[model samples]
Target: MSDRWRTLRRRIITPDVSETRLDVRGFHVKNQVARDILETVGKSFLAGYAIAAEAKDQSIAERRIDALQPRFRGFAYEGAAMAYAVIDGLSLWRRDNSPRFLAGPGDRHIYMAYVGIGWAMARVPRFRWQRLVLPDPTLRWLALDGYGFHQAYFKTARYVYDQYRDPSFTWHGGGPQSYVQRAIDQGIGRAMWFVYGTDAVRVADAIDGFDPERHQDLYSGAGLAATYAGGADEAELQTFWQRAGEHRPFVAQASAFAAEARIRAGLLVPHTEVATRVFCGMTATAAATLAETTRPDGPDGDQLPAYEIWRQQVAREFVAIGRN
Candidate 1:
């Protein structure tokens, strides 16, 4: 095994008994902080998505724009770009005694940037259908294409750069990109397995050499083996899989971009296709189902809301992809 992986394995499998609880506590605190940051960002993203979706409705008359246009006009593109920049900057900040609860200033900046982008997109007078094209569909594809790439770039760059910022850090388990990709892939499999007869105990045991019970504190509520012990009914699993298939196009595109970025960064084998078809299929199914159920009026209903639909869709896909 690579030294980095060895180190991580040792840390998990044979932790120093005296320091075990302390380490667990540290991890929990950091994780909670991270979760909070993600939640805030997610909410902001959902709001932006909803506004944009409303603007995209074909049925809405031009006069209606007077009321809704101002809702997102100020931030649209600028807000999103700023959010990306902020995230990039925050990830690079270094300070001693920084509270784990708050992300670095860069985090706040990134949030602002995203807000700006959303506002701009939401406020555009004509709904700019050209901006929605993807995968080289049109001359405007470049702008749309950059959106995901920018997000991934900021996330991966921040993570990798953070590790490197610490002189003692070593890159391991393939590399950050590969590691993340594998986790995403395996997470999907594990989640599916969990739906079958796998339990938290089994998952914990499956690791190189860790005591399941001792590590129980590391898990979120869903991580509890007891939660999955009952196993999902076959019919439910089948239904989920069916829905996942519909989202294949979007998932495939995202995975392809991620894989390409990893390869270009030399973080993984140049030829590796880190994107998994199976996982994409599963996640797509879940996303489509969530979109349908959560926004029955399509992306136009005020009652259900557009951004909420997008958020639910993303959440379902994330769940279908499993925990990473």
Candidate 2:
């Protein structure tokens, strides 16, 4: 079935281009290179969103998304997934279309697609949340990561400056709900990388400003963003690796996660390889393999979800290996 009022919905959903600009967001601007990295991600996200919001079918959107270069292509998929989630969540006028995208072209970018669902959560109201397609219990927390990233990126002053936690956040699994904030903090940490303009010192300082308990998760998020988005050079990545200190294992774990995301999406680039080397002491391929092999098989656990268990496994392995 064709999506109704596709044009009108597209106009309503897509954000303004200027809004993602550093100056518009009043975020740090380390240099032109950093500025480009941040802006390119924004542009790529918008492009992907538009592809989904306006395209007639999933196949059309896939073709357009595949045309993008490796580094930015995954971001576009992320944006497209966000659009699909939004469409499915808000478009009660029709049947769910998100599954089509998620099961097909989006399968490879599943990590990003979940994050994209989180982006939809940020835009879609709580009442409509039930309609969203979040079948995978283990990876569902990633939607919060996307929501956290969205809030921290857009509401920088409230989230980043004040370090505000939304006591009202309602999403929780059958197990302990305490991990909710930790998952969100990871997204906030990811946003901080862009907020700090990819400056290793500034990013580390921002992480330090957070509550001590949140440092590890924050480092994990920032590590993923740094590796995936890739504005920093080899030295900068090494600097970030050193700055992680005791949290290096989480950073290493997250770097591996990023590697797997890129590799699965067929978007792995040299910068990702370099970042993986610095953090995981291995190539992106090896790091991704570790992430895959270590991933726990089964449903959500009684205490910790499978996602957290997987992350812990990878982190422990890095700690044991002596990250450099």
Candidate 3:
């Protein structure tokens, strides 16, 4: 195994006994604070993986998650990401027979995972940009923000340079000209979204300084972030959906994806399905079927690949369906 992987394995499997130095390749991660956060993430992963692995059923797993809180205490956002890694690991180890508690949106942990990913990215040390491939599920997700951070940092830097170079200078605006640019912007917005606790109003409040006309990509980025993190209720989602204005369809599509994630997470019980249905037009049945089919025993037999395919299709559907 790669040294990084071995290090993580040792840390997660036997944390108390393992006091080895953290060595992520290409990353100058010497900061104690950053290392502690990373270690917390690892511990969080182990907690989820072990619980899911041992549970008799979904109910048991759900009940077991409560005990993991103290282990992940103090760092809510990072802990959530770590928990997700555990779920992902559980999904991988069990393959076809993944537990239901770790399954869908009906479970509360799914939303926590998305939030955790956002928090991790926001706190990523600039030095670790090159080693975005650190051997951890949560870090892999966090690495996605590098694209956005590159654009945000440079664009803002240029903006700062211009303002300082010439007091009378006006801001020059640009839109994303390529997929990478769009991804970068989206990543940035997602990070901000997490930092703001996925609250649409809070995110809106935070990005109010951004000009929608000039920073179109960031606007879209914020929309995607809010939609996915879904820190708000259905009524709030509707309000935020309308708040997106020009980016409404994109935001709606993101909400649809969140709904899909929730469904896959197994949160689509009969009484609770309406909330997501209203939020994204994705019904419980569709979500549940997709969740089932993506499982190892399901027709497709692989959750990760199946989920991406479903997300794309659902996104297209939401866009075509329009915000109405």
Candidate 4:
């Protein structure tokens, strides 16, 4: 499977070595593996949820997720993390049966997972300051693109009420969950960076309308997006970095993580040279060197030393730079 992924990645990434084409024919092939990655992680989440549900303890689910992290690999590892958010959210929901945990964007699994994070945050006594706020664009896209799934899940299946249905229940009846919403919205912003490529102005504008309080979230999303799908000139990215303000280091680190994740996923190639240079302040060659250094080639159930080295180098560079 790894070899096959390499082959597919080479076919798409090497052919153009310029524009990252999303509309090209056979693009679905690229996503087939991504979909598989999502599925595998989803199954794991369900299994974890079952354990937590049976034990009547959410910590059981958290422990299951912690145990599975080293097992997660490849480019779509972050996607798996997203799935775990759902399990975590559901675990909390099963424990307390709170309405907040019950709310989500219907059955859009990704959106549900995002909402799950919000749900978890709401119930967790630790992060009480965090609010549940879904950004406009996140809602827009999920409603538009995922309407069918939403309708099937919310209307027909009634997933929100599956475990416990209240006769007078309404989605958002008790108000909204903001923290995870911002996080997910930030991820959407990052996706936009890739979708729009180097069009920094457009990406910035899209998230600009968001409330100023959420700029940090937007910047975090923008940083990861720029790192992975960036094509903007340095000045444009610098402007973005400045907007992130004190959070610039955070954004930069996320960018480094994005770069490494892309490399591990087998999606990185010379074509993304511009992104590496702009976001990481490193030549594509240098960035690729780190990618090769960090490639997870260890035996299953084993930790790889290269992974730590890559992480340390990324952290050191970003910390030294401090901003941008």
Query: Candidate 1 on 39-119: residue-level lDDT in tens?
Result: 333333333323222322212312232233231222122222332222222333431111210133212222223323322
Q: How many clashes (backbone N, Cα, C below 3 Å) per candidate? A: 27, 0, 12, 8
List, residue by residue over 1-324, the lDDT tens digit for candidate 3.
Answer: 365653464355322313212342112243455445434534554454444334444455455555544324212323434333333333324422222322442134444443343333334443322222223232223233433432332343332122112233221111112232333445566544444444556555545555544234444455544443333456765665555566554554444444454454443333234434654466655534543343332222133323233434544555666644
Better of 2 and 3 by TM-score: 2
lDDT of 2 by residue, 292-318 (tens): 999888876777777898899999998
Superposed by TM-score, candidate 2 places the C-alpha of residue 88 at a distance from the truth, in angstroms, of 1.4
Q: Give all candidates' CA lDDT scores.
A: 0.27, 0.89, 0.41, 0.40
Please report the candidate that would top TM-score against the real structure. 2
Q: Tell me how far the alpha carbon of residue 174 in candidate 4 is from the true structure, in angstroms, after superposition.
A: 21
lDDT over C-alpha atoms for residue 75 of model 2: 88
Off by over 4 Å in 1: 1-243, 269-274, 277-324
Residue 162 displacement in candidate 1 (angstroms): 31
Better of 1 and 3 by TM-score: 3
Error of 1 at 123 (Å): 22
What local lDDT score does residue 227 receive in model 3, on the 0 to 100 scale? Answer: 40
